[model samples]
Target chain A: MNIIVCIKQVPDTTKVKIDPETNTLVREGVESIINPFDIYALEEAIRLKEKIGGNVTVLTMGPPQAAEVLREAIAMGADDVYLLSDKAFAGADTLATSYTLSKGIEKVGQFDLIICGKQTMDGDTAQVGPEIAQKLGIPVVTYVSKIEDIENGQIKLKRMVEDGYEVIETETPLLMTVIKEINEPRVPSLRGIMKAKKIEIPIWDASDIGAEGEKIGLSGSPTQVVRIFAPEVSKEGEILEGEPTEIAEKLILKLKKGKVI
Target chain B: MSIKIDLSKCTGCKLCVKACIYSAIDVVEKKAYINNNCTLCGACVSACKYEAISISKKKKTAFDEGDYEGVWVFAEQKQGKLAGVASELLGEGRRLADELGVKLSAILLGEKINGLGKELIFYGADKVYIVDSPILKDRLDETHADVLVQLIREHKPEIFLAGATSFGRSLIPRVAATLETGLTADCTGLAIDKENKFLLQTRPAFGGNIMATIICPNKRPQMATVRPKVMKRAQRDDTRSGEIIEETILNPISSRVKLLGFIEELSDKVNLEEAEIIVAGGRGLGKADNFKLIHEMASILGAAVGASRAAVDAEWISYAHQVGQTGKTVCPKLYIACGISGAVQHLAGMQTSDYIVAINKDPDAPIFDVANYGIVGDLFEIIPVITTKLKEINGG
Candidate 1:
C-alpha cells in the first residue's frame, strides 16, 4: 500500500462563526473547506487504496487555491495530486509547514503510509503531524483512531489517548495522524468526478519542492506572530430566565452557595 | 521576518482585510495581498493604517542569545502520576524563572518516578530534571524526543514549557523538531519579553477567534505548550527547596514504534483533563439518545462528560467526548454547559472553566458568554431538575 494523503485547505473553522455583532470573527460566508479532519485522511487513504493494491498519493501546501484541496482529494479516491504552490510558500509555521511537507514528501517517491489530519481546521496545531514525522525520520502514529492490521511491513495501529486506546506497532516509512474515528469518508463518484476533471494537476513550486529559501517561509517560521487580539468574553453573564423547575432550583442554589456543586 | 505590503502605501482600505484573523488578508484588485493563510501572525501588521504593513524581522541566528539559561518544565508523568499540566507548568515556570533571572527547572520523565522530585519540588521547582528510565517505557515520541532532546542540548533552557497534553502534544513537536528550536502550541499566554528577554507566546487562532502573541526571536530554547487549565497550580511547598538533577540517558535510537497495549475507554470515568466537574453536551443535546441526560448530570455531579464539536460532530459523543478547540483544552472546576452553543470553538475549551455553568435553551446562547452560571432552560426541562437535585444531595 503506497498511501500518502496530507491534505489541508481550512478556513471553515466549523464555519468560522462568532460575530454576534462585533464580538469578532465572521470571516463572511467563511468557505474554503476540506480540513474537517482531512476528510478522514482522505478516507483512510482511499481505504488503503481499496484494501492493499497501492497508489493513493494526495498532498497539499497551499496558495494556488490550494489546488482546490488537491481536487478534493481526487474526488475521493485519489490517485495522484500534489499542489505545494509558492510565493515562497507564504508564512508557514508548524515548523515551516513541517519543513515544507518534508520536502514535498521527499520529492514524492516511495511511501508506505503517511496520512495526516489529526489537526488543522485553520491550524489547531496538532503540530503538523508530528512535524511531518520529524521531517521524515518517519514513525509518527498520533491520535490515529485505527488501522489495526496491515502486513509484511508491519502497521497495526489504534493510538487515541488521554486515558484510552494505544496499540501501535509501526514500520514501513510510516507517519499516521488520522482521527474522526478513522473512516466514513467516501462520497464522490460520478466516475470520480470524471477522474477529477481529467487529471492534469501538477503544481509544485518553491523550486519544485527543493524548498529552502532559508528553509521555506517567512524566513522559516520559528513561531513569530507578534500580536493579535480579541479575547475578552464576559458578555455579562447571569441569564437565568425562570421555570424549568425554577431555573433548576435557582441554578442549584447558586451552585450550592457558590461552592460550585 | 517578512510581511511587506507597500503597493505605494496600499490604499486597499480593507483594514488589512479586517485585520485578518487568518483569513490571511486579501483585497485583490484593490491591493493588500499576503495569503496562503499567513501565519506571520502580525495580524496584518497591526491592521496597517497607511504605514502599509512592514515587519522585516532582523534575522541572524546561529545560537548565542547568550547561550541560554534555565526555566524548563515538562514534568508530565502518567502511571506514576503528575501531569495536571505538571503543576501548571511549574506555576508558569516560576513566573518565567522570575522573569528570566533564571533557574526554575522541572523535567522528570517517568517510570518509578518516586517522590516525583518531591512532587516537582513541591510545586515551584528550582530544579528537578530526573530521567528515571525504563527506556522511557514506551512513551515514545521518538523516545520522549530523545530524552527531551538530550536534556535540551545539555542544559541550555531559555524557556521550554510543556503540557498541551496528549503527552505534551505528542512530545513537544519532537522536541521542537529535534532542537532546530522554536515551538509554540496551545499556549494561553506566557510572557517575558520586556525588551528582548523573548518568550512571549500567547496563542489561539480561529478557534478562540484569534489571539496570537508568539515569539522565538532566534530560537535557542524558547519552546512552549502551556494550556492545561491555563496555568496556576504552583502553591504546595513542603517548605520550599531545590536541585535533584539525575539523568541517565542512552535509549534514543531503537524506534520503529511498538507499544501494543492500552485500552482504558471503559466509559471513561471522569478525568477529562483532571475534571473537577464538567458536564458538557451540545448541538442542544437533542439527540444521540440525549447522552443519557449528559450521563445523568455526569452521574449526579461527580462530573466529566463533555462534548460539543457540535456533539462531537453529531456522532453525539466520543471524540473523547470533545470539549472545544478541536476537542479538549478543558479547565474544569465546575464547567456544566449542557446544550453547548458557545462555539468560539466551544469557548476555546471550557472558557477556562472555574465555574462556568450554562444550560442553554438559547436565550442568545453563546454559552451565556462564558457562563459563570446561566440557565435559560429545556435541557430536557433542566436536566431532570439538576439530576433531582443531585440525587437529593447524594441520598443525604
Candidate 2:
C-alpha cells in the first residue's frame, strides 16, 4: 500500500505575538517547525508502509523554506517529498487550502491512503480535512486515536468520540486525519538525516497543481478577514479565600448572585 | 440573495437547524423547510450533516433596500444578571457602531428583562431593545433565536456580535444563518473598516497556526462570536444610562421544545475554564508514582492538575487532565509548567494562561518565555519546596 502524508510548517506559537499597532501576527522573528500533529501522521504513515512494504511520500504547502520540513520528513523515513509553494498559494483559507492541496494530490498521482493531522496548529479550524475530503469526494475519518487493522484493501481504526471511541472500518484509498494518540513519532537517525541532505524536494506552484486562481488565497476564499484586535480582558473576580468548605460557601454565594445555580 | 433548501435530501436531522443559531429551519412533516424569513446566510452549510442545505437568493423581493446598518449586541443575562461577556462585546460593538456612525443597540431578550437594558447603555449601548416575555425566562435556543431573528429583521443591524460561550455560540449562528449572513466563530479579535463599515472578524485558525480574518462583505449584519477572556469586559458605570425601547413579540409561536425542569449537572468537575492557578505535569515525571507529587502540590495550592500530551499518552492521568490542542484549551490565571519541554502541540493549549511559572531542569524549555516566573531546576525538587512554602504562608 502506498501512503501520502500531508503536513505544514507552522510558526512556533510560543514566539508568535500580535503587533500591538496593526493587530496582526508578528511573523518576522518567529521560528517555524513542522506541525506537531502532522508528525504523528507522518509516523503512522511510515509505520504502515513498513508493515505493508511500500513507499511513503510526505507533502507540505508553505514558503520556500518549508522544504526544510520535507527534508526532516525524509530523515524520519519518508521515501519522497513534495513542496507546494508559490505566491498564489499564500493567504489561502481552509477552503482555498483544501482546494490547492486537492489539486496537488491529484497532480502527484494515485495512492491507497492519505494521512493528515486532525488539524493544523496555526489555524484551529478543523474544517480543512473534511473540506478536502469533500472537495476530493473521499471519505474522511477524523480524530482517529488508534489504528485497529489494515488488510485486503480495507482499513479499520478507532475514532475518538465525545465520551468514548467508535471503531470504524472503511475501504482503501481513504483519507484519515489522526490525533496525537495514534502513534509516537520517531526521531531521525544519523543515516536517515544524512540521506535527507541529498534528497531533493520537488516544488509545485498553483499552475502545476491545476488549481483555478479564483479559488486560491484571499480572493478565492469566500470569507475575508476585516480586522484583528486583542480581546478585552474584563475581571471582577471574587476570590473565594479560605478552606474548601468556606471557599465553596463563598463560591455558592457568588453563583447564587449570578443565579448560576 | 435568498435562502434555498432541497427538502428531498433533508432528513430533518435538526443538525442544520440546530447548527443555525437563527431558528431558520422549521422541521415540519419530518422535512426541513425555510420561508422568506431567512437572511440567506450560509452558516447552515456547516451545520448540515447530509449536504441537504444550500443558500442563494430568491427570484425577487422587497425589504432589500433597507439600510442594514448599526451594530447590535444581545445583552444576554441569566437569573437577572448580565453575562460579563456581554459587556465585553459592547466595548467591541461600540467601536463598530462608532466607526459606522450608526446606533449601538442592545437587545435584551428575557422575562422581566426591562431594567437590564439600562446597564447595557452604561456599558456603551446607545439604545436598549427589550423583548420581555414569560416564554423567554430561561435561555432556550428555539425561543431565543426566534426573538433575536425578529429583532434583527425589524431593526436592521449592519454588524452583530455575541460572546463565543455555549449560549452565544449556539444562539448567534442560528440567527446569522436565518438572516443569511456570514458568522465567524470564536473570534480572538474584531475591527471596523471605516471605509465600508465592515466588521472584520479575526480568529485563530489551523489550531492557532495562523490568524484568519473573515468578512461578510455583501451580507448585511455581518455576525461574529467572540470568546470570553479573549476580550476585556466593558467598565461598568452605574451613572451612565440609555433609553429603553420595550419590544413585545407581535405573534409568538407556541414552543415545541419544552423546558423540562433544568437539572444543572453537579459533577464536581473542576472548571478548568475559570481556574486561576493550574499546576500541570508531564511524562518526565517518570512514573505514575510521580503524579502524586504534582497532585499534592496542586491540592496544597487549591490548583488544578493538568498533564501534558506525553503524560496523558502514557496513561499516567485521565484525558480530561490532559492539556493540549486535542485535549483542552485553558487560559488559567497562573500556569505552572513542570517537566514539559513546551512542545508546540502541548503549548497551544495553555499558552493563554495569565502568569505562567515554569519549573524544569532545562533552562532552554520554551515554556519559560511565556512564564512570568521561571525556575531552572528539577520539578521533583521545586514542587515539594513550593508546596511546603505555600503551606507555611497559609499556615496549613
Candidate 3:
C-alpha cells in the first residue's frame, strides 16, 4: 500500500489583511503554514501506512521556501519528500499546476493512492486534485470526509455533498481530496522532528520530471486575472443602539416593518 | 511574468519581500527587487505601501466574435428535482442572451428527466436540450464532463453558465480543462459586455476582501460557475412555450468510482440552502455550549441553524451548518446573526439574504454594514427575549 500526499504552504487567511489603497493582499507579516486541510491528508496517509505496511511520500509544488511544508510532513511520519520547484513552474494556475504535479508523480514512479486537501485557502479552487487525477488518467473522489474501509484493492469513502454524505468505492491507484472532518492530525514528536531535520528532500525541476515548457507555467494557464478591486460596500443600514430590551424591541419593529417576521 | 517595482516610491519596508511566497522579491539598500521566480500573483503588489509595484502588460489573444451563438445554462438536477441554482442560472442566462440577441438554451442531463425540460422552458430557456439515460442517474464526474464536452464541441455557445454547486464546481472545471478553455468559479455577478459580447464574470477573491472581474477573450464557450442564491430565479410561466431537443450520447465511458449509498447527518435535517430563515452563531457566543441559544431561537422561528467558520473550526458545530466562502452559500429570507462580528468570508456567504438582522455587543462590527436591522447589545440577553417574543406572537 503505497500512498502519496500532496500539501501546500499557504498564508494564514485569517491574519491576512488587504491594503485599501492598492486593493491587494497584504502578505507581509503574515504567517505561512501548511494549508489547514492538507494536514488531514498527511494524517490520513500516515494512518493508512501504519495500518498496512507501506511507504508514504509527500509532494508539493511551490517556491524553494515551500520545502518547509514538505519537512513538516516528514516530521509527521512521511517516509519521503519531493519538492517540485522551478522558475518555469511560476504563475501556474490549477490546470497547469496539476499538469506539473502529474509529471512529478510520474517521475516518482508507482503509487497505489494519492491524497490532497479538498482545496487551498488562498486558491479556494478544489479543481487541482481532480484535474491531476484526470491528467494521470485515474479516478478521483473529492470532499471525502471519512474512509469507511480499505481492502482487496478497493477503498470505500464517505464523501460530502450539498444535502448529505454519499458512500463511494474506488479501486486503488486512485486520487482523493479530503476535508477537515476526515481525521485529527497528529503533532510531530521531538524524535520525529529530529529525523525530519536530517532527511534530504529531493527537489525536482520541470525538465527533470519530463514536463513540456509550454505546459508548465504562466503560458500554460488558460485563465488570467485581468483586474482586481475592492468590493463595493453596500449602503449602511440603520443601527439601533440601546439596552438589550430596547434594542430587541427596535429590531422586532424593523423586522415587522420589513414584513420579515 | 513579473511586477515592476518603482524605486522612487519604495520605502524599504521590506513588506513585499516578506509577502513573496516564492521568495522572488528581495530588499537591499532601501529598495525591493524582483527575481525570476516571481509568478506575478499580485500578492506583493497589494502589500507594497508606496504603490511601487505594477504587473506587466499581457499580449492579447485574438478571438472571432462572430463564430459563437447561443447562451447556455447547465440545468443540474438531483433525484429528478431541479436544483434552485439551475433556475437561477437560467434567469441570468436569459438576461445575457437577450443582450447578445441569441437564444437562451439549457442542457438537462439525467435519467428519465424529460419532464424537467418543460419546467426549464417555463422558467426562461428558449430551448431545452435533454439527454436522458439510466447511465446518467448518478453523477460521475468523468462521464458528465465527457458528455458536456461532446455537446459543447458540437454546438458552440457563446457563454455557458452553471451553478457553483458541488456538481457544477466539479464538472465544469474538468470540461473546461479538457476543452482547453477558461472558467471563472463562484461568480457573484455575470453580464454580457455589449461592446465585445463577452461574458463579464465577477467573483469575490482573497477571502472576499476584493472582487475580480475575469474574462476569457480568446476562448469560445466562455464558462463560469455562479454561486447559488446570488442571482434571482426565473419566474415560472406555464403559458410560455419553447423547443425541446433530445440528444443521443454514444456508449458512455464507465466510471472508476462507484456510489454505494447516501447517509444524512441526523442532527442537520434542515437543508441550509433551501431554508427560508437561518439563525447563525459566531465566536462571540463565548463557548461551544452557548450554541444552544442559537438552536433555540432557530427552532422557535422554524429556521435552520448556521455557524460561522470560527464556530465550525472550534468544533462547536458541524461543517454542514457552516455558512461562509468555504462553507455553503445561502440566501434565506431572514438571516438572524447572533454574536457574529461578520468577517468578510462569512458576509460573502449570506449577504444576499433578503433581510439581515445582526445582534452583537460591538456597535462597529462589520455585520452592521450589511444588516437591514442591527441591534447593538449583548446577544446573550437579546436572543432569548427575541425568541420569547416570537413565541408569544405565535400564541405559544
The candidate that wins on DockQ is 3
Q: Tell me the number of clashing residue pairs for each predicted model.
A: 0, 45, 0
**Compared with the true structure, what per-residue lDDT tens digits does model 2 show for residues B177-206?**
455455677777788766755577887653
lDDT tens digits by residue: candidate 1, B1-396: 567898998988786676565577778889978866675656667656678898786577868878889888888877687767888888888988997788898888867785789878988898898888777766878877888888889888888888887778887998798777778888887888788788888877767766778888887888988788767888998998888988888645767798878888887574688877888878887789978988887877877787887777778677887877666678877888787778667787778767788887778867787787787767887888779977987899
- Per-residue C-alpha lDDT of model 1 across residues A142-180, encoded as one tens digit per residue: 888888888988888987787678898878878888877
**2 against 3, candidate with superior lDDT:** 3
For residues B1-396, what per-residue lDDT tens digits would candidate 3 score against the true structure?
A: 546899999989887775564557888898888886577676677667688988763555645667779999999998899998988899999988888889999999989899899999999999999899887889878788878988998888879999887778777877887876778888888877778666888887656666677777777788888888778889999989999999999877777788889888789555788787999999999899999999888888889999999999898989999998667778888998998899877987888788888888888998998888888888888888888877877785
Clashing pairs in model 3? none
- Cα shift from native, residue A124, model 3 (Å): 0.8
DockQ, ranked from best to worst: 3, 1, 2
How does chain A of candidate 2 score by TM-score against the true chain A? 0.91
Winner of 1 and 2 under lDDT? 1
* CA displacement after TM-score superposition, residue B130 of candidate 2 (Å): 25
Task: Output the lDDT of residue B79, model 2.
Answer: 68
Cα RMSD to the true fold for all candidates: 24.9, 16.4, 3.0
Q: Estimate the overall C-alpha local distance difference test score of candidate 3.
A: 0.84
Docking quality of model 1: it rates as acceptable
- After superposing candidate 2 on the true structure, give the runs of residues whose Cα lies further than 4 Å from its correct spot: A15-31, A161-166, A171-173, A189-191, A226-261, B1-186, B189-199, B204-214, B218-279, B282-287, B293-304, B309-320, B325-327, B331-348, B351-396
Residue by residue across A1-261, what tens digits does model 2's lDDT show? Answer: 888899988756655654454334444455678888899999999999888899898888777888999999999999988998876665565666777888888887888888998766656655566556546655566677778889987777776532244566667777778887788789999999999999878999888888887667544554554333333212222222344344334433443354322
